[model samples]
Target: MIHIRKSGRDDASGLAAIWRDSVLATHDFLSRDDFIEIEKLVCEQYLPKAEIWIAVEDGRPVGFMGMTESHIDSLFIAPDQHGKGIGRQMIAHARALAGILTVDVNEQNVQAVRFYRHMGFVETGRSPTDDQGRPYPLVHMRLGEQRPTDD
Candidate 1:
């Protein structure tokens, strides 16, 4: 059975792998050089500094989320695990811990935008460029007061 748990020092590589695979699958808008640069940053910097929660199954990490207080810095599910309710579970976990949850989804990723909306997150703002000042836009969303059932 899959479960959510706090990440450990050893889980960094696995989480990074999940991030790479998920990005390759969902972030098709990223250029090759951009992807490489981001991958290095995610592995070498972000993963080490962020507070993370991981979705583990059979002793391995299948997905991971990086969070800061009530804000979700990043959420990535393994490409093979998409549509399997892992993301939903992670979001629920985050909400329980943080009370109010927030996330920034890439505007180019229609799937992610739709998923967040389905999870009861409403868009609050937008940024023309990502944190790195890239051309990719971001849709900032926050969870509503009423939680939606996973239908």
Candidate 2:
């Protein structure tokens, strides 16, 4: 079973590697220069600012997610760890913590778009260019509000 927990500075390196590897596996459309720049920013800047969470399997770090009050800034899994439900676990935690989950995913990433839609997030908006102003398009999604359950 995968365990989920808050991350600290010590987990930075592992998180960075997962980010790099995941992007490499799925974001092949990005140019080498853009990819390197994004990798640098994610490792050196964004990861530390976001409320980071790690998913560990067999005592090893396998996936992570970063969120803020209004957005899920990042979510990545070790390439070897895909199809293992780690992403679903992380998204469940994000929904509980953030209350509302909003995420921007590259439109070219069909698997990710399908995954988010499957998780109850619907496309609320779109941008012609990604956050970095690159040619890649972005699909913005938001989860539908949940109804309260009786006690």
Candidate 3:
């Protein structure tokens, strides 16, 4: 059986590997250079403020996810484990911890957009251009509308 658990310091390398693999696997939209830059960005900006989780099967990590108070920052599952529902479990685990979850998915990433839609996350709106002049649409979503958890 697969289990979702909080990621510890030791899991950083595994998460990094999974992130790298995911970027490479999705090269149709994300280039190799983009992957390198984003990996560095994720290490610097996204890691510290967010909480990480791992999906384990018989003590081996197969997937990973990260979250901040304002967003479901990152979710990456090993390519081989994609259809096994690890991603869904990871999202549910994050939801349990933080009821209101959000994410900014690339508009061109059709698979991600469909996945988020299946998960019940609606698109709030687009984001402003950064210093680089790239305007990426931001999809904001909340898990529970009635009562958000304090934890």
Candidate 1 regions exceeding 4 Å error are: 147-151
Model 2 misplaced stretches (Cα beyond 4 Å): 146-151
Which candidate number has the best lDDT?
A: 1
The CA lDDT at 25 in model 1 is 91
Q: Once all C-alphas are superposed, what RMSD does model 1 give against the true structure? A: 1.8
lDDT of 1 by residue, 1-151 (tens): 7899998899899999999999989999999999999999999999988999999999889999999999999999999999999999999999999988999999999999999999889999999999999999999999958946698
Comparing 1 and 2 on lDDT, the stronger one = 1
Error of 2 at 100 (Å): 2.2
lDDT score, candidate 3? 0.72
Score residue 75 of candidate 2 by CA lDDT.
85
lDDT for each candidate structure: 0.93, 0.89, 0.72
lDDT (10s digit) by residue, model 2, range 106-137 = 99988888889988899999999987789999
Instruction: Report how far off residue 44 is in candidate 3 (Å).
Output: 5.3
> Clash pairs of candidate 3?
none
TM-score of each: 0.95, 0.92, 0.80
Error of 2 at 50 (Å): 2.0
Give residue 27's lDDT in candidate 1 (0 to 100).
Answer: 94
